[model samples]
Target chain A: MKKQWYDYLWILSLTYLILGFFNIMFAWLGLICFFVPLLISLIKGTKGYCNRYCGRGQLFGLLGGTFGLSRKKDIPKWMKSKWFRYGFLIFFFAMFFLMLWNTYLVFAGARDLKEVVTLLWTFKVPWHWAYHGTLIHPGAAQFAFGFYSVMLTSTVLGLITMVLFKPRSWCVYCPMGTMTQIICKIKDKK
Target chain B: MSSIRKKRKAFVEQADCVACGCCVKVCPLGAIRIISGIMAQVDMEKCVGCGKCAKECPASVIAVKEVTA
Candidate 1:
């Protein structure tokens, strides 16, 4: 049973589309669906979920591998700099903290749609435009932001990684990857 | 010929594993288990080389290769 690269791509896209649709509709369940595979993948290997079932991973892996950009054969010292790794980790964690803060606000009965939209606007980045006038309600923006922040932060980190180092550098400092590595280490110890 | 085939089903390589557990879950003969704190390993005698485990492993790590009887 030889596997083609596209088989992984198909699985990933299917999972993403199904999970994304469910997430956008039910909110909490969507969050669960999104993080669970990530948790599983991290514990297993990126190859398990990222390569096998993540649409974003599949897309990036395909694009990078196709162009001979996927393999990280000769990474530079600067790209592997501890400062850069720590910086990205700190930034990723900060985004997670902000998501938590927003979640706290939502739970505290502050449900003003305008206020939520305004807060997002304060970020003043172009990507916020995608969330500007969507069907997403104000009460739900925090949850949305939690997901969006991780995605956005990773995207930014990914761009930096692609530019400064090898294309898949985000995998090195990715919080999700970090979490998985931690799990794998623990699994190894026991 | 059939006796020669029986000798070939023992070893597994850990490096190529993606750890999806498909092999662990689908082993009809109950020959494979994902070792605790390690990757999957196969119990040779129990393996029938039905190819179920190899078929399901997402990483394509498991192979039914010939070995010494």
Candidate 2:
């Protein structure tokens, strides 16, 4: 198939990552990636965002399809099962809520903003170098750091699965995909 | 010459389709669409049976088959 304009969107994902690395404030931009899929799903009642417009999916396709970085193997059946997909979605929402809680803590002045990005909700990698003392409320920056960690962590997982399986294998289990799928179903019912 | 013509069309196995939308993305003709966010339904009239959707389908539920018309 000929490349469409959206095929080049992978660069946006890469650029977002690079920008976030240089200045943590750029992490707030990740909300575009986070929210756009849902809005599309709600309004369009389709997985069009996941299918055609996801920069992360495009990135994986470029790395694994064009560059041949993947094994091109089929993802395992268990990972594609409904139980696992829904379970992972729930886990993802839990992590998102935890990030929100941490941001709320910072917002409430109950805790200072942590200058670290937690990977996989476990390892807190010190990100002091990314912090340059933003004048914005520390809570906002705190949310940025937490949100960036979530985005980066998911990208890492996507890359790993892309290398192991098909280029777009991550689409099978992506939380946003699941959420959008649910939204599409609900919209279809209406 | 035989009156019957063999036309290739894409058929989706609804039972197995995960509705991942991978096929929907790769269909050059926009022949495949997700059915209520569930399974992929191919528009037989538009599907040229190029096999792109079948190849792109992660669930391997899409198949291009020859149909006699």
Candidate 3:
């Protein structure tokens, strides 16, 4: 198969993810980077992001593909079941909204930044150990949290899918992918 | 190309299936699998109705059908 153009997007994301952990200002990019694809998916559908330029998916492949650490095996039947897919989608949406709400509260001064930073839902995975590799100053904590949250969410889902199935497998059941499909269905109808 | 497009997912005719793994290998989502090392099976949830398997199948047994509610 021919190499796709977007296959290289991982380089940019990988750079930001690794270097941003140190310069928290660069980490702030994660806060807004999601919208670029969300807008495109509204027009071109999930394929715009999932099939083409998903950085997280590329990272998963880099870490777990043939040359990487993971061994390939057939995914279990239960994991492929409809119940698990939809349930994960629902849970994902709920957490997404909750994160936004918490962020809003911090910005509006209704809640402390510390509270938002340490929210129970902001779960981090082992990949974050790389960021701790940097000597993060206290002043950059806000940006660090944004960087951490974005990586945490994507890495959590990516790792789960990679461990259970193939790295790209999660794209099939992603909430954003599902939402993009719904948008395309509506557009096709009109 | 069929100009009359239908939102179709892959459907396998059991009798015509030779258990050849072409479709399984070609499927982007890994949605098609050989069950018990015998027949080909499609996972509807994983399938985006992409028709990649149909185009790749050697047996000419798999076709995409309109799955309207």
lDDT of 2 at B12: 90
| Over 4 Å off, model 3 | A31-33, A115-147, B1-69
Docking category of candidate 3? incorrect
What shift in Å separates residue B25 of candidate 1 from its native position after superposition?
A: 22
Cα miss at A138, model 1 (Å)?
2.9
TM-score, first chain, each model = 0.61, 0.97, 0.72
DockQ metric for all predictions: 0.05, 0.47, 0.06
lDDT of each: 0.51, 0.86, 0.58
Clashing pairs in 3: none
Model with the higher TM-score, candidate 2 or 3: 2
Q: Deviation in angstroms for A51 in model 3?
A: 1.3
For candidate 3, lDDT tens digit of each residue in B1-69?
756655668898754443434466568898988553235799987887788777645335578888753
Each prediction's interface RMSD? Answer: 9.0, 2.1, 12.5
Cα lDDT tens digits for candidate 1, A62-149: 4444464444333454443446545755766776676667766765776433222222213533234334444645546556645544
How far residue A102's Cα lies from its native spot in candidate 2, in Å, is 0.8
Predicted candidate 2 versus true structure: per-residue lDDT over A1-190, tens digit per residue: 7779987888999999998877898899999987888888887777777777889988888889889998888788888888888899999999999999999999999999999998878889998888888887999999989999999899999999898888888888898888888887778777
Tell me the tens digit of each residue's lDDT in model 2 across B1-69.
999999999999886566778887788999988877667898988989999887776556677899998
Model 2: residues with Cα > 4 Å off, grouped in runs: B1-9, B15-18, B46-50, B64-69
Residue pairs with clashing backbones, model 1: A23-A30
